[model samples]
Target: MAVQGIVTAADRIRELDEINGGLADMLNHMGQAIKALGPNAQAGSDDLDARKEVFQEHSRAAYVCTQAFHARMKRQVYALEEAGIILAQAHIHSATSSAKHKQANNQPVQGQGGAPPVPPASEAEHITNGGLGNLDVGWLNSRGNKVGMEKEAELLQEAKILLEDELERRRGPAASAG
Candidate 1:
């Protein structure tokens, strides 16, 4: 789904570029047309002058609007990145809980020959290791030291509760802010 979102964003950027290019071409042609009229006091020249002013205003407005659009697109990309991170964390928490639960129940994890199951590598690992390194999850411990294992299930549950609360609040009728 994230990949789809990224591809859509890329397509939209290409479209925006094409639109801006077309606008530039149109503005350039308009400028050339105005210059072809060449500073004459002939009739309809005043009308051309008025058209030139309107074109300039339109060009300015298009440029300003495109700049604002680019800013918004940047913010959207940042938001998507954040959402991906949060989802990844939640996934890790879920996987860790499943592994621990299975271990506690003395059940043979799937395809593990009765050994304890390991949590999957996290997004941070993929980013830092270039997709080829140890699969240890390095969550922070209570003293701020990095621990190469799963976080406590209680902490993960607490975070889940908080996120659920936030989601519920957002879905409330009186919700006016994120």
Candidate 2:
């Protein structure tokens, strides 16, 4: 029964490892696709109005892609931690079972206890970041700030001003006469 339990935990750890690998591959593909967009990874145009629209579109695409990548990476980190815990428990269980079998056979056990040492409270803090320890929170906040309708409106306003100026220049005295 103990062997079966250990096998199950090992299988779970392997599955999680495979999932992490697949997620990494997926993230790499996403990065490649973003790079393929162009040198700027943004939309470009010669005209102000068109360029504004393209910029908004590009921003939305980039924001969505980045969010997805971050989410997946977070999940991967969580899965890795779960796998580690499972493997650790399996080890502890195997050690305890062996100690019990040795005692039953009147053999001396080697370790003081069949359990692992307790980690310090500081170590708990290290894992309590909710799998976001490696993430750049400030950068994400700045990116979030750049998203949504407000930024689009600001870009449109700038484009409108430029278009009006160009129109006035083209009209010259005719615009005032009309």
Query: Quick one: best lDDT, which candidate?
Result: 2
- Which tens-of-lDDT digit does each residue in 45-75 have in candidate 2? 3455554555556556656656766776656
lDDT of 1 by residue, 1-178 (tens): 2474454656656766866676676566555555545554234466766656665665666566567657756565455455453222233334567566657878655537754454444544444333222333444235463342345666788899999999898789666554
Q: For model 2, which pairs clash?
A: none
* TM-score top scorer: 2
Models 1 onward score TM values of 0.25, 0.28
